[model samples]
Target: MISRSVTARLMMPLAICMLMLCALAGVMIYAQLMVSSANRAALQGQENVTELGELRSVSRALQRDALNLINEPAGEARDTIAKKFDGRMEKFADGLKKLEGLDAHSFVPQDYFDSQHKVAQQLADVAVKANGGDQAGALEDFRGKVRPAEREASKVADERIEALGAEVEKLIASAESADRFAKILLLVATIVLAGAGLTAGFLITRRGVVIPLLGLQEAMGHLAAGRTSIAIPSIDREDEVGNMAQSMARFRDQLAAAEKAKEAQAELIVSSIGAGLGELASGNLEARVDAELTGVFAKLKADFNRAMEELQGTMQSVNRATTGINGGAAEIRQASSDLAERTERQAAGLEETAAALTQVTTGVKETAEGAQSASNAISVTQDQATEGRKVLTEAVTAMDDIQKSAQEIAQIINVIDGLSFQTNLLALNAGVEAARAGEAGKGFAVVASEVRALAQRSADAASDIKKLIQGSGELVNRGVNLVGQSGEAFTRIVDQVTEVSRLVKDITDQTNRQSTTLSQVNVAVREMDATTQQNAAMVEETNAAVSTLADEASRLEQMISQFKVGTRRDAPAPVAAPATVHTPAPRRSYRTQGALAVAAAPADDDWAEF
Candidate 1:
């Protein structure tokens, strides 16, 4: 796999910037979750406060009702007292039951429970008295026993409800405090993370990218100035800069080798030429021009022979020496020109390598930015899920409270029905008494009958109310169950969402790592480019040097043109070789040790004859 690297020029800063962005995003998400939780908690607390208040009101109403029933007059006692007691008892019981269910979290204490139980017994005692035909006894019991007991129970319930209110207040305060703390923490985290990220970016730019490149620039300047011996630091980075440094070292090596080779060849040529001149001065013109004779000597001998034969011994030695020297000087000038051309070619190659490295650096930078963006997105998702969970929990709680309220309504309906039943019985008795009293009781008997009918209607109404409330309770129960299921499903969703967020975070983390690595690689490529550029420049210089040699060979041919070595006295005269001419060979042929370098020379090419 081709591992991604940070191009030294851009990697370090990009990484630091991305990391900081991720941290800031995390802090934002944290704050969002805290705020959401606080809002839900506050809303839930308010709901509890409202439900508690309703329960307290219901308790107070029941208490007042019991007292009013007890205070009724004798005639009213048999009618209103019994009727009211029945209706109120059912209402009180149903209300209490509903209150119990509504907010179990806000339940009245055990003391209240005990008190209410005594109140119920007193109520039952009054009913027994009335059923036994003791109207006065029932009235007395309601006034002396039931009312007082119910008042005590109401007091207990009031105290319990008050306590629940206090608890709700505390929860609200706690949620507010948590919200504040989360905000502060998020702020602090953001500041710290931002600072750290900036610092990291600066360091990366300064040390990892900028500084190294500067050093490389200096090294290159030195090399261009012909200071091949100047030493450069060996940065062992895995980035482009490191690669360039290594490449530069290799280029330096090749240059040094070429320099050495040129020097050695020059010295050998000079010595051989001097020796050949001595032989020519002594008049021994038949010395073989073989490989043993260096470049300088061979060219000198060839020039000397051409001059001596043409001048016909008049100024042979003097002229040959001067021409030989001139030829050697020309060859040196050609070598220099060749070196310059080679150097230019090497520079062009280095430029190409540098361009490639720059591209690598850009790619690494983009990757880092993408990673940071992904991390930020993940953090946001996590916060949303947290808030949703809190809301779901609150909804579940509210539904439970509503269910309890429905049950209380059912109880109140039952009590009303019971009261109506008692009223009907009393009316029936009054009707019977009027009928026994004859004509004087006729009007009273009609009133009694009307009372009976009203009681019957009231009873029917109460029964219908009870049925309605019971149906409501069933619906509420079903709703409660559904809410509970929904809450559970929300919980699961939150869990799954959290997991997905975590996975996104992990992906971002891995991307960050890869970005860092790519930065290093980019740096390496840049270094390689620099080195390759230097190497190519050196190759160009070598090619130029070769061209100079070819040019010098042409000049030697021109100097030798003064000779007519192969022109027979009876044959046509040979034309001097063209300065830049070349003759292509059809095939390659080998020569024996004592034989000439070329085979029987081409008759059409004069340069080949030499």
Candidate 2:
């Protein structure tokens, strides 16, 4: 037997081992975090040291540029040098700010930053003097104050860089020491945890696995040898061994029960077999054995009972079937007779239907061909109508354009008429002015009268042209309206032709479908005629078979009469009724003329009227 509580037995020791390992891991992780912190601190210290060095370098550069700016003559060169000096001063200030903002207060002294600020201020003063073109004075200031200040600031920055470097070195050393310590501690913890795990494993294996398994093995050996009298010693334990012991005890009890049942089953088998046989010998076919026994004996009991049941059931079935067969044989004979009569009548009907289908198929084929021809003609008519509609549409559009042109001509004629009237008015005014000049203007008056008459003639011509143009515009508009009407008529003709084409096509498709369907019907009718003839032959054979079946039923009845099925022996057998034949109804015809009537009625009235 295997241990059932194996997981529980090992859980505590494994859990402790895991916890120790977790603690060791946590210590290592903490050491790693400390190392990371140290590295960050060292990195900040290095940054501060670098900043300090840059600050010192920038201070020296500022001093040099300031000195050069003072020595440069009062010109563009001096201004350029002064700008460079100012840029250097700005850089020095930024370096100081960067150093101050660095997280290295522990390494860089505050007095170093203060000294740099003082040097920046002195440089600023020297830049102001040089920018004012006072080269001599600026030189004096740079020498007297800015140079000394920058030197002092440089000295302080150098000292600060050195101090920061030493601090970084110390941080690096501390990080290395911590790393080494963490490694040593992790190694020691791992060794101790491994030793503990080994010890715990040995103890658990000895206490929970080995002893219990040995006891279980011995108990299983006893069970294997069929020694139910042996004791299972680990039954009182609270582990997998105890469970195994309990299972063995249960198995032993079941075995004892099984043995008892075996003996009982043997006696039952003998008694049941004897009783059943006696009953059978005594003419009681209903006698059966009990099949409630368990294990291997149950199969024996069941088989014996099943055999007796099958014999009894078979006898009873045979006895009953003899009567049913007598009546069923009579029914089959009657049904066969009726089927033969129906088949003969169906064959006659099918022959008639085949002839009719042949005639219908011929008619449908002719109709399909005619409809196809009509469909083609209608398609041609639809195309001509469509072309006519296009021509009428163009005529309507042309009439519209002519109407617009006529209206434009009318407008121009009106403009010409207005100009003629103006010319006539100007000529009349000239005649009045000539009359005011008396006899000296007599000849001028005649010319003005002549000019007025010509103007009047021009006005008359323009008026006549305007009236003609207006009449033409009206006529064109009327022509446009008439053209529109003609276009609409053509559109209606096109629609009618299209509708006729659609209806003709539909008729053609329906005719084709009807022809196809009629062909299929004809084929089916022919096949049905053949099948009916075969059926008639089969029906004659069935009648002979029915008579033989009836004779067999009689013999079977006589044979089943021998078995004493625990019932009265003198019971009367049922007599079969006489057979009867029923005639079937006649089949209906599905001809293509009926389909055409349905298809043509709607299409001719609705579409063909157009």
Candidate No. with top TM-score? 2
Instruction: Tell me the deviation in Å of residue 391 in model 2.
Output: 99
Which regions of candidate 1 are displaced past 4 Å? 1-371, 543-610
Tens digit of per-residue lDDT, candidate 2, span 494-599: 7657756775786687678668756765775576587668767866765766566567557655644554665323343334344443334343333223321100
lDDT per residue for candidate 1 within 1-610, as digits (tens), equals 0122223233333355446546655555555455455545444544544554555454444444444443333574547656765776676677557556755534556666566667776766766666566767877877787668766765765565456545644544454455446434533443443344334434543465446645755664565455679775544655445555655555455445544555665455435433433443343333322345334444434543443232222122212322332343343234334433443443454354345444544665576577667667766766776677688778778877887887777777778788888889998999999999999999999999999999899888888888887787788788778877777766756655665565466556645654554455345435544554554454444344434433543453343333223332333433322233222323323231100001121223211111
* Residue 41 lDDT in candidate 2: 70
- Candidate 2 Cα misplacement greater than 4 A, ranges: 1-5, 74-77, 103-110, 131-136, 183-207, 227-236, 246-610
Model 1: number of backbone collisions: 32
Cα error, residue 291 of model 1, in Å, equals 37
lDDT, candidates in the order shown: 0.52, 0.64
* TM-scores, one per candidate: 0.36, 0.38
- Strongest candidate by lDDT: 2
